[model samples]
Each structure stands twice: as C-alpha cells, then as structure tokens.
Target: MIPLAGWLLAGGSLASDPAPTQSDFGGAGLWQTPTARMAEEGELSFTANRTRPYSRYNVTMQPLPWLEGSFRYIAVTNRPYGQPSLSGDQSYKDKSIDLKLRLREESRYLPEIAVGGRDLGGTGHFGSEYFVASKRFGPVDASLGLAWGYMGNRGDISNPFSIFGSRFDRRPGRDELPDTGGEFNSATYFRGAPAFFGGISYRLPSRPLVFKLEYEGNDYRSEPHDNDQAQRFPVNLGVVYRIRPHLDLSVALERGNTAMFGLTLHTNVARRSEPAKVLDPPPAVRESAAGRGADTAQVDWEAVSRALEDNAGIRVSRISRRDAELFVTGEQTRYFYPAKGVGRAARIVGNEVGGDIDWFTWVSTREALPVAETSVELSRFDALLAHDIDLDEFRRGVERNPPLPRREHVLYRADPPRFSGGWSLGYSQNIGGPDAFILYQVSAGYQAEYRFRPDLWWSGALNANLLNNYDKFRYTAPSRLPRVRTLVREYLTDSRITMPQFQLTASRRLGTDWYGLAYAGMLESMYGGVGAEVLYRPFGERWAVGADLNWVRQRGFGQDFSFRDYEVATGHVTGYFDTRYRGINVAVSAGRYLAGDWGATFDVSRVFANGARMGAYATFTNVSSRDFGEGSFDKGIYLSIPFDLLQPRSTVNRARFVWAPLIRDGGARLSKRYTLYTLTEDRDGDLFHDNLDRIAD
Candidate 1:
C-alpha cells in the first residue's frame, strides 16, 4: 500500500508551524507550483496527472527575462512477469525538457560586479544554478552556489509478485549472481558522471520560524554500479514558516546514503487580494464624479508631442526645407568617471527628416558635443561637403539642378539621391601626437522610420551642418595668424565658426516572448541633453549575444580652467534660465595612457565565411592622459575570401568593371576624388548609387 504519489501540495502556515508527526516529510519539498504575473503578455502553463502505473506532466513558459522553458512527463503502467522481461515489455517511459536562459548574472544591486553568459547549456544539458556574492555578516544569511544537473528519473515501484531478496546499491544483496543477469540490467543508464558542484546556504534569524543550513556534495564517476562514477553527499535542515501575508512554509531534512524528507508551500502569485473593507474610498471622490461629467481638459502640446511621438519615442525637430533658418541646434555631452590626468572626447550629431519622395519616411535627432564646448576654434586638417535629397525627388532635383539633365538624364534608378563629401581632420601631439584628439567636422543629415506597430519598431532623424577646421592648424609650422603660446594663448583668438546645427533621434521594440526596450531624449545646446538605453534578445541563435550601455549630460558657455587635477569653467552667467558655465582647462595629468590610432584598412572582394578573401584591419584606440587610461582598446584581425582573385567577370574599355583591391596605406597612395567623377557620371554606376550626387557634387 505505497500508493502515495501526492505530487506535492502543502499550503502555508500548517497549523502555525510545529506539528511534524508524519515522519518529518523528506528532503527538498515546497510544492504548490503555479507562478504568474500580469496575466497576458505571452503566457503559458500546463498541469496533468493520472493514476495506475504512472502519468505526470508539468510545463511553464515566459520566452524572455533571460529565457526559461520547462517540461516534464513520465509514463508506465503494465508488464513485468518473468525473469525481468528482457525486451518483452516490462514497462518503459521517460522524457525530459529544460531550456533555461540568462548568460550573465551580477545584479542583486551589484554584488561586487559580474558580466554576461552563464552556462549556455553546456554540462549535462540542464539543471543550472548560480548565486554567489552574499552578505549578512550578523545572523548569517550566507550564499555561494554553482550546481549542475543530470540525475534524470529514479521513480516507480509497482508490480505483481516478486522473487524476494534483492536491493543492489540500496543495500540488501545476497544473490551471488542469479535471476538472469540481475533482473535484466536496466537501472537507468546515462550516469556519465558530469559533475561540478560548490555550495553554501545559511539562514537563522528566527522569530516565528527560520532556520536553514545546507551543504552540497559532488564528484563524478568512480563506479558504484555500471554507467560509471558516483560520489554523493547532501545535507539540509530547514524550518521556515512566515505562514501569512502572502504565505510561506518549509520543511527539509536530507543526509546522503538515501535519507530524505521535504515539504514546502510558498505563495505570492503576484500578490494583491485584501481590500474587502480595509479603508477604501477617496480619489478626490473618484475624480470628483468623473470631473463633473467629463470634458474640460485642454493642453495638447501637439497632442502631447504626438503622445511623446507615438507612445514614448520622443523625437521633435521639424522645420527643414533644406534650411528654414536653423531652429534646432543641439549639443550635450558628459562621461565623467575618469579623472587623474584627464583624457576624454565626445561629439555625436545624428539627424533624420521626412516627407516627399518618401524613401520610406522620417524624423530623427542625436546630439553629443563637448570637447571644451568649441565655438569654432578648430583646425587639424579639414575640408567638407555632404548632402541627401529625396523629398520626393526634391522638387525634381531642384528642377533638374545643374545645367539641366546631367544627373544621368533624370536620376531615379529605383529611387536615387543620397550624398556625402570627403576630407577628414586630425592632429594633436604634444608628444608624438595621437594621444586622442581628431575632430574633423562637417555634416548634413536626415533619416527616417515611422511605424506604430508591426511588432513595434521606430527610428527618426534630421541634421543640418558645416565645418572646416584643420585641427588648430596642422603642425602649426606655417603659423602666422595671431599665433602665440605660453600655455595656450586664450585658445588662439577663438575663430572656428561655421555654425548652423540641428539634431533628433528615436527607437522602440518591446516584448513578445522575452522582449524589452525603452529610451528617453533631448538635445539643443548649452543646456538640453537627456539619454537612456536597454536591450534583451531572449532566444535567437548562431551564437547570439546581448548587452548595451548609454549615458549623457552637458552644460556650456566657456571660461573655466584649472590644470593640476582638472577643473575648467570661465564662462559663467548661471541662475538657471539661459545658464552658462564654459568648457576645458582641466589638467592634472598622471599615468595610464594607451592612445590609439592604427591605420591600415583594406577590403577586396567578399567571400570569407571561413577562410581567405584579402581583407586587412587594425584600429586600436586607448585614451588616458589621466583617469585609468586603458579605457579603450579595440582588437582586430580580418581576412575575407579572395581565394587568389576568384575568377568572375571584367570589362572596362566597354563600360563594365569590378575591380576591388582597395587598400589604405601600407605603401602609401590612396586618392581618387575628382568630385567622384561627377558622381560616377551621374547615376546607376552603383558606387552606393551616387549617394545624392556625391553630396550635391
């Protein structure tokens, strides 16, 4: 009469605790499983149970939170009559499923620090656990764990008539080899000892009940009965019992060599259920009778900026018919967390605009500027020009701008018109330069994406700009334009102006199986900067990976200086409204610098998915004149498929060429910019589809 397959059920506060008559229950118990939260949002659950012989089921799902998908099932109910029935039906059934996720862990309010990818289902397929980092020094509350699993099934005890006398490893042996190979083998196979264990658990603060102490054991394979390796050890003693207010109850006692006892019953299920006469009422009298019967609330700041640009994407910067007098200019930067000798640079400006010839739509913004808040004073080697027009063929390309027709007689090889210019700037060496400082500026922008739902995806932009500074006059050798330096002569008469700026940006994509995303915004110089970032990709493989970081802050007007430990501010006019407090003049140099700038970039023909293609890359940049310098270093190694110039097709003399051997400086010489030969003779030459006639020729 051992038909006690109770499949777990032990509700909380069991008679106010203390009443262990039924032999203290047996190890690892706390059943009453059925967890939930929020109801919808990709739900899933299952439960099944049968009788005779066997039949059980359990299933759960979420899809993301680092992913978790569980499964369990068992079946067996007949056969078993002769000498352990070799293959003549003696009962067989067992199937399992476990696919847990979370490649990284270290966030219990940051316990010393941790980083991504934890057990990508390596050892023993499933049964992964990790907790580490613990503290409660006073009354104990310890923690430290790392357990792996694969003991898969050890159940079932039912049949008709036995031969009496057999218990192998459970200890009763005395057959000395009989019953045809000890009852037809089969003590459950695959015991391949895939071990690795480390454990620690503590808790003792009793008041109504609390006392836990655990110890784990492991050592895979050393033979204990076929299938290889077996060394066990387990210890646990528990008693917890808060009992109410969301309930909880525990009961544990385990000690290797087959001793076990358990019972648990925790409950919360997204708590909330206690307001049946607990002082309720008064939300200003339920909103004063629905605001005196509705209607009378007006403040539609453009429908709250189009409901924050369609439910929290916030992108605002409309006004650009090429240049409707720059009403949107932005610059807000900050990243202070490095201060010893000093070295940090930031300058981001992204834009997007829409309407006309809808190359798929727009509205964008991105601003990040603050290298001492330059008001022009730039020159390291500069030259610029960039453009993009598709406002529906932008007035038919400005009514056929440029000697009518020349853009390949009506540019439109499936929607053309995108441009860009050349000549970047750099140079800043007080000691062989390259210690970071290459600000070559010049831009023109517009980008777009507007979808309310389609699994929800969004992006927008707009940009307008110009700049040409040869980095403080490259090498200052031929210097004569008011030049004088005793330690930086009033920033050399500040003269770096070509100001006409603007920017905007937006993004969104949230939940379905393990989804998440949210972002905030703002950008409009001297005091207009805001930022946010988040990402989670539950399950998508080919060695999938995830993690992201973002931050921003700013203030500008210019007149602050302090070099010895860094501190610059000399442009003050603060009191909040139209505030001002300038940039740069902070110097207190130390050690820890890994300045970066490794040239060499070549990409010829593509084919390297596994080997060979003629590719070359090397770009490492570390900046630190003071703050823990080693803050940057990008590794590189590349080689694409070229299999010794793979034979394809070539025909130049008759207007058909596919030459690709582009290399950047290894023997010097890489210049070919005759205004991109009038944008590859106007169109379809596919040099990126004449990107807006090479930025408006």
Candidate 2:
C-alpha cells in the first residue's frame, strides 16, 4: 500500500472532468479531503457550516486560475477559551487561513491533481496537509487521497516517509499555548502516520442536487481541549441542493450519528447585471452649422460654465480662448466615466460656440492640479455626431496631450461655495472573538462637502447611532505594545452622535505630473491630524510613486475634537502598479505605523469594467509576536461596489465594506479620506478604452 502511493501518482484517468462544486468544508471537497477542483477566477464565496461541536464561517476567493484562498472562523461549541464567570457563556472561536494550489488539470487521460494546507495559520487545532486527485465519469465524480497531521490521527497505517528516518514516524506536537497564533508551524507537516480518505459525488439527473459518500480519515481521538469525540462508523453521507444560481444548501450525516448543514452564497466580481438606465439625451447635432448665428467673443462664459455643469457634468473653473481653440479648465463632477464626461462637454462646446471654433480643449484638473489635457477637433466631432463613425477611430483623431507649461489666458473665473451632501445607513460588527460572540452597531450618517475653491475644500460627517450593543464589547485582547488601537468599547460608547471626520484640504498642481495636498482638522474617528502628500504620476502610465507624511494626535474619548497626549509622526513611501493582467492592480507601501513599528503592506485588487473592486491586504511589522498578541499581523478583505450597479443612473459614489480579523497595534495605517491614485484614475488609458461605449453620453 505504501508503494501504491507512487503508482497512483504515475497512473492517469481516462476522461476530462469539470470544475468541482464547494463541499461542506467551504472549498472544493467531498467530505474531509479536498478534491482537485478550482473555482472560477474572480469568484467570491461565503460559506457557513455547522455540525455537532463546531461551526465554521468561510470567506473564499479564487483570484487566480490555480489558486484558492479561504479565511475561516471556527467556533467550538463545548470549549471555552475564557471562564464563564468573567466573560459569559461564549464558545471558543479560532481564525484560520487555508490555501490550495492545483498542480494539474484533468485531461482525457489524467486526473486533476492538487496540494493544499488547512489551518495553515493560527492555533493548529485542526491543521492538516494533503495531496489529492479527482476524476469525473458522467454524473459521478470520484476523489481519493492520503492526509497527514490532524486528518490522519487515526494512525491506520505507518508513515511512508519513515523510510528516510525514524523521526518521520511521529508528527511533532504543536505548542498548546502560544503568545501569538498566526505563525505557521511547518516542522510537523507530513511527519505523521498517514491515512486514506476518498469519496464519490453523484449528481441527480436533471436536478439541482448532489449526493456524496466518503470514508472517514480521522479517528476523532485528538480533539482540541481533550474533548475527544466518538466515531461510530467510518463512512459519511451527504447531499447538496442548489437553491439559486448564487446560493446552495447542503446536509450530511457523519459518523452515523452527527448531522451537518451548510449554506453558501457565491458571486462573480468579474460580471454584473446590467440595469436599465434613464440617461440624459445626447447633445443635439447642429443642422446647417453656418445658420446658427452665435458670436464666439460675446458668449456668456459664466452662463456657459453653468450650462456645462448642468448638461455636461463638468464644473468649469476658468475659460480661455486663444486663436481657433477654446480651453475650459475644470473638474469632472457627474459622470463616472471620464471619457463620457469629456465627450459630452465637447458636444456642448460645439453647440454653444460657432463652427469657426476649430478646437475645444478640456484641461482635466483635481484640486487645480492639471492631470491631463484633451483636445477635440470640431471636424471629428461633427463627423462622429452626424456620420456612422467608429468611436475608437474618432478618439484616435482627438489629441490627448500633456498639460501646457503656462496658462494661456484667463477669460472668465467663477468662485462659489459648492455644497454637496448625502446620507447612508451602515452596520458594523465584530465576530469570532473572546470578547462578545458578536458586537454590532447600526448607524445613520450624513456627509457634506463645501468646495471653496477649485483646489481647496471643507468636508464633515456626523453619525447618529440608531441601535448598538457596544456595552457587550468589554473583553480586550492582551497586548504588550502601546495601545494605538484596540480601544473599540471606549470609542463606540463615548457618544450617541459622533463626528468621524471634519477637515479642510488644500491641493495644488505642482506640475503636469506632480500634485500636492495639505489637510488638517479631525481626520478620522480616533485621530486628528495635519498631513501632506505628494504624488508623481505620468499620464497613461502603468506605474506611479507617492509619499505622505502626517503628524497626528489621538482624539479625546468623548468623540470630540479635543486631542489626547498620544501623538505620532507616520508616513509611507508607496508604489502603485497596474499589472495589465485581468484588471489586477498592486500596491506596496513601507513605512512607520501608528504604533511606531516599522512595516510593509502588500495590497492586490481587481477592478471590473463596471468599476466594482474586490481586494485583500496583509501587513507585517517589526513588533514581536508576543507584543502583537493574537493575529500576529494585520490582514483584511474589502469590497468596493459602485452605486451604478444598483441605481438607474451613473455616479462616482461607492459603498465600501472591509473586514479585519483582529484590530491590533502592530501594523495600523492612517485612513486618509482621499489619495491621488484614486483622484486621477481617469488618466489611465485603459479606463477610457474600457468605457468607450458611453462616448456619446
């Protein structure tokens, strides 16, 4: 049987297999062992499973073709990490991370092969490592593999690696108690006695249902906390029902006595449902251009600015005309797509000015910093408006140039207190911790922005608590470092109405590719700071660099503008890269964190054509594991959904949700309101090309 391991690896299956569906364990699996199946790229899945002694919640994503990543929280029903007298009845909840890599795809003659590690980080309560293979025949899919560590605790057979040394006969025991739990314990991997686990899944004919049967691997003798469970039979049976295209439900009878149930919700970030749009009518094409008696010199530039705002979604700061070219310097205010906004503004220019105006130049600006200059020829505009023209060809004819070094002329300028506001209802929660099993808050907030100048603005937000259970947030994880964070209860319970942000920001365009900003006031819920940032981004480039420095004082516990004595100077030198592969973007930053710890952070996100984004980030600092406490480093996942995905009209607003396992002091970065990379996203050539279908709007 030990030699069979080598033979199995050399043998091949006879048919190609389809991708596997998620099993009760959240990844592609049958029962206890994972199968050689991978989810579609950009797929995000949330799964919940419950059995006798454990409940698991998983967030899984397939960011690449051969990789699957899952972050999970497991709750042990009968085990408590804290005494009941102090922390109320709470089950021990542990956070674990898992990853699987596919080595070979199923072909006509070979089975799909994969290797994976479960519970790779955190306490090794249920950790295991395995190599598995699967093949499909008609509606029946079969999987088989050998598992080590906790999965093979039954010791049904001798360790195959023992041939190398007797030390490989027994797996090393994990430290029962560790100061921090996020480190991977690699010494014990593949060192234990191995056991066999296999299963078969059958799909019901023409029905959205699947049945599975598997042989157990573990004997349940080494359960956490010495609470070993009883295994009456070694076989397990299960069934899964597809409730909807994005939803699934599963149930299983395990060990002849225990029952398990699971629910999964899945979505693909790369695809979205197109909504019916009620769009503004396109600008009317000029009929007999010579008949419209419009004087270029006598045009009401102020009213023309107002017309541009109302019709074209462009807020003109200054307008100038030199020779046959009319230049409008402004910011985009409405359309989410920059090209659509520029095209609309150009059409408005052709309609307001006479045909003698040979060119319309749009100077795209942010905080009065010129980002790019777009020149549209009147001839190309007329042809696109009247004739059947390819938008790409027409755009090629339009000139995209760097901003001019000097201002040509100032024909008109307008300064007004532009007021804009909106309100949203939000809910936040913390789960799977020794604190309360769940602490949550529901709040409603309103934000208002007043633009005093093209480069200066004031903004503030006030949130009113509608409902909350923050009083239950009493338990705080132990930490040895300065408490830069982990004071959630103090901050959440300080006031019913809290102002998270109120600031005045001034920005300037230092050069065509350089921009700068200075901001001060209450920056966030816990910090009040003055900061400055500078960025250098070339037009239509794949990479850029930036640096930001801030001097911040902690806010008072009352959630007011008063400052605390705790202050820090922190900043990062960051680089941004567009991989130009599957719309992936990567950012790397290295700097001193809020806790005075030096560290680096890596972030990778995917932006769909519709502007929806999904990403995850991880940070590691110089702080020792003992000082950092549980979750040795900071890590989280986030999703940014565009408002237009649900609304009938397009807008620049987005609803963002982020989740971090533990809020420790090791690697905390300042959460600034804006960044130059985001502000100048439109300057990317791919963005304009992706949204060219909206050129007419």
Candidate 3:
C-alpha cells in the first residue's frame, strides 16, 4: 500500500498526491536538478530566479498530462551581449526552449519515469538531455536521473551508447554553432559521457513546505564563455514555502557557497475562476398563465429579444416558429461559453412561449452568418431548470446542429448593434536578430467599428506611444529575400502616433457550412493589404478547410496612408484540424508567401479550459538555411490570453503575445485583422459539444 504521510493537498483535493513545484530553472524539479514529477496538466507557471552570474525569467506550460514545455530567458550579468561598441553595456541574454515527456506513471510498485531535453532548440548554453525516475515513500520523495551535455559536465560515467557507434561518444561544444542560435542541435543530444544525479524532497507533515537535497551532475568547470565557478561538492540544499495560494518562494544554497533565491507565480488554467456574476441579471423565466397553452400572438417577442440580449447575452436578429418549435436566431454577444448563453435563451423562450412550445432552438451567428444551433427539449429542460435533474442527465435530450433554413412563421426581427469598439493598452516587442537586441513599446490604442449592416463594418485603430525604449533600436534588417517583413525597425521608431489599421470588412454565409470574408485597408503595421478568405467547415465535424488570397504593398515608416514601393501577391490554402482530445488544434497552410517565396507553415496549439491558447508554429521555404540566416527557418511560440480570466466582469478581449527566435523575411503572410476561421470559431467545434453539461449554468 502507498504511504499516506507523504501525500498532501496541493491546489487539488486532499486525496490527490502532492504535486511538484516549479524548479529554479523553470520546470518541475528539486533545487538545480530535475525530477520525474510533472505538474498538473493545463497549469501555467512564471518563475524568476537570481543566483550569481545569471538571472532567469521562465514561463512554463503543461499542455498535456504527460507533456511539459517551457520558454526561458537567462541574463548573464558577467557577459556582454556582444562587442561593447555595438551592444553597449547591456548584459547578455539567452533564450532557451525545453520539453519533457512522461514515459510511465507512478504506480504502487513502480516509480514514474520521464525523459526530457533542456535548451533543445536554442543556443547550447545550457543544453542537456536526461532520463529520470521518481518514487514516494512516506514523507520522502526520491528521484534519480542520468543526464548528458551541460548538466552532465561531471562525466563520471562512461558513454553507454558508445558501444553502438563512435559518434555516440562525441558531443559538440557551443562554439561550433552560429552565434545567432535557434538550432535544434539534435546531432549532439545524448552523445556525450553521462553523469548520475539524484535528489530527495521531504514534505513536512501538516506544513506547507518541502525540504529538498540534491546531488547535481554539472561540475561547472566547462561553463559557456569560460564563466566557470568552483564546485567544492556536488550537493545542494533548498526549501520551498507555499507563501500564498498562488505563490511559491524558494531559497537554496548551491555549489557549496552560492546563495540562490527564486519565486514562482502559478495557476491552473484548467480551473480558472473570477468573481461570480451575482450582479448581472439572472436568466429570466416567465411562467405560463394558469398552466394553459397560449397563443403565439400573445407573446411580446420584441421584449423577449431584449431580454435575450440583456440577460441571456444573445443578440436576437429574428425569431420564428415551425409547429411546436420556436427558433431564435441571433449573434452571441457576451458569453464565451456558448452553453451559458444557450441555457439562458432557452429559459427565456421556454417561459415566454409557455406550454405551447415543445422545443426551443437557439441559432447563434457570427456577424449575420449562422454558425451553431442548439435545440433543447422543453420537457427534459424543465426538469433541469427546476433542479430536479442534474446537468449531465438533462444533456441527454439536448441536440446540437447547424443552422437550419428559416422556420414556418416569423415572430420578431431586430438589427444588431450599429457600433462597437473600445480603448485598450497595447504592448509590442521587437527582436533585431538574437544576442539580446530587443526593444519594447507600450501604447494607448483606440479601435472602433461602425456597422452599415450586420455583414459589413468599417473599423480603424490609432495608437499613441505611452512609454517606449525606441532610442535603443539601432539594428538594421538582414534579408536576402524581398524586404517583406524586415522593415520592423523603421516602423518601430518612425512615429510616436500612428494609425496602423483602418479597414472596411464584410462577410457572408455562402452556404450551410461555407463562410466568406473580405477586407481592405491598412491591414497591419508592416503592410497595407486587401485580402479575402473562404472557409468550409462542416457542422459537428473535427476538420475544416480554408483558402485566402491577398495583394499587399509595404506600409511606410510613418504608418500612414503612404505606401512603399515593395509589393507582392501572396495567398495560402490551409487545412485545419482539431484533436478534440487534450485541446490540441493543428493547421497547415501552403502557398506563396509575402516575400515571393513558396512554402508551407504548420501551426499547433493547445486551448486551455479557460479559453487561453498556447501555440507554436514553424515555416520552411525554398530558401536555403544559410541564406535564411540564423535560426535556419521561421519558428515562433504564441500565447493568447482572454481578458475575462483576470477581470471582475466577462469580456471577449484577449492579449496576444508572439515570440519568434529571430525575425526574417521568408514564408511571411499578410497579417490580416480578421479571418473566417477565427470569426466562426463557435461553429461545429468543441465549444458547444464539450460544454453540453453546462446548459443550466
């Protein structure tokens, strides 16, 4: 039997085992070494640590139960970015990507096993690969691992894989790679002499603390840039305190003399929460008079439409009836969770139409285009509405469908709102290759859209710099291909107040599963373009296909109406797939790019339970790696965070961040403001199907 003494409640229930906390280097580990333990899936952690020569900022994500990923930036205070003349006195900055995969789960008799790589696709400053196993016994959790490369610099053990080939005994040093970084360095992975590392973490009984002691494998004698330190002993000691519900503080003594401190701010994206919606009006449920079947003309649908919009968050454009079915079609305005709005619409219609209606169908639209249809049987729903049946049981009678043709009778029609916009703070970061030449800008941005019809609108945005460090932007664009995206530096420092976008957009529902979008204006900061897209997404399907075409001219340094001489016709035909399991979404696009290059781009992302999306993408074209310059190709990671997750009220706004290892001009696409796939996100996907159980929430 497993010992209960070591198991303690973390962010989960008391029955759940104590989960691993963030390591100083930004993953789940003990002191400076990693363990086989993995954080709970869908958790995001931000960690900052300071030791001696290095300070690190890391963002780690658990996109899957058995997978972990992290992106970190390490600042080497003792090292300059480059020659002092070019980089000034700024410290050196190195970015790294890491990934871990679980091979086996911990059982009563077996320890958990995991294999991972650090600094996999970046500069090999901290490169290493390892295999680890961990187990728990009473109050102590023990781990042992073998590592290669930087972490295994001690090299006490022989190369076990060398027997197979001579190449297995050789590991390349960092000096062999390009200084611009961004390479996978797969040839040297696990090829060096290995070393053993082990550690044990003790959870204090009834206390929110974990005491850790570890034997590190890295001797620090072969540090990059010759910044080596003396290692009197391989042992390190540390302790982590749960200072707050969402905060972790760790202090450690490492390398026999150095003092280390780190803090991690983390949350489970799978279980995000905000203040309750107690202040918002509840779902309105009008009762039938004297339990009698009523007439259709007696219902004031205009009032019902207003109620649906006000309380249910559904903007009613029209209401119809066919036999005992009442159809209410409108755009979803407020709720990101379709189930919540559908539930409220059902209650409002069910109560207003009385016993005469047997089914309620709410068709949700994007712009004027129908996307998803939710039909709820009144009899089964009444039980749920009354709390007699739980949500799961009530969902049995629920049906999700595509938008159907107009019903028999029209009851109400109202136009959607004519204006929508907001003012928000925006931040952008620019990278002029690697080696710490980064610049950031903060701006006050205002965007508004004026609608002429439900399917047509004109939108524009103006940004004024609030705070920035543009004076430090001194790097020049490096591109052998057409200068499609390399003009970022000029755009960043051109003008403080600029209008990046002012566009007219229109969309149409071509067929039951077809959507078309067209827009023209200043498309993005780097380019001015006109583009159109069409998407074919079947109802209740996991796959979709789309094609887009655009003609674009580069925008001027002033970001105004003036255009540049460079122009190109670029487009792509893309296929999108959603692996409904584990919230993974994949898309592949192939066609001509902005720089007149032909290639394919592959994008993969994970959607957390709270609507946050974390994704990575890569592009490879006909251009050779040497011509494409450092990083070999184009690759980046992006995170889209919904604003509602941190607000007191609900919102459809999001904060998007994209970090490319190095910026280049190959395989670039026009950055359009809206795409058909994004506008019709609620259609025939996981949004409604996976959330059917929340109909009464």
Q: Per-model C-alpha lDDT, please?
A: 0.23, 0.78, 0.81
Distance from true location, Cα of 110 in model 2, Å = 1.8
Ten-residue segment with the worst summed lDDT in candidate 3? Answer: 1-10
lDDT of 2 at 356: 66
TM-score of each: 0.19, 0.89, 0.93
* Number of backbone collisions per candidate: 73, 0, 0
lDDT of 3 by residue, 1-697 (tens): 0011011112322114445777778889997778998887767777879888988877787878899888878888898887666578878887788999999999999999999999988888899999999999999999999999988999988899899999899787777766656778888889889999989999899988999999999999998889998887999998999776567789999999899899877766666554466556776663644553378778888888998888888888889999899998888777767887888887787776666789998887887788888888988888876778987788787888888676378888896678888898876766433324457788999999899998899999999999987777666657788887777778888999999898999999999899999989999888887889999999878899999999989889999999989999999999999987788999999999998989999999998766778788999899877677766778877777665555556556676767676678887788888888887888745657666665776
Question: Which parts of model 2 are misplaced by more than 4 Å?
Answer: 1-20, 155-169, 278-295, 298-304, 319-328, 357-361, 374-387, 390-395, 398-400, 406-412
Q: Any runs in candidate 1 off by more than 4 Å, and if so which?
A: 1-61, 64-120, 125-149, 152-251, 255-316, 319-697
Candidate 2 residue-wise lDDT at 547? 94
What is the alpha-carbon lDDT for the whole of candidate 1?
Answer: 0.23
Query: After aligning candidate 2 to the native by TM-score, how far in Å is the CA of 425 from where it should be?
Result: 2.5
Number of the candidate with higher lDDT, 2 or 3:
3
**Clashes (candidate 2):** 0
Q: Write candidate 2's Cα lDDT for 305-353 as tens digits.
A: 8877876778888888887788988887777776777777877777777
| Top candidate, metric TM-score | 3
Shift in Å, residue 586, candidate 2: 2.5
lDDT: worst 10-residue window of model 2:
1-10
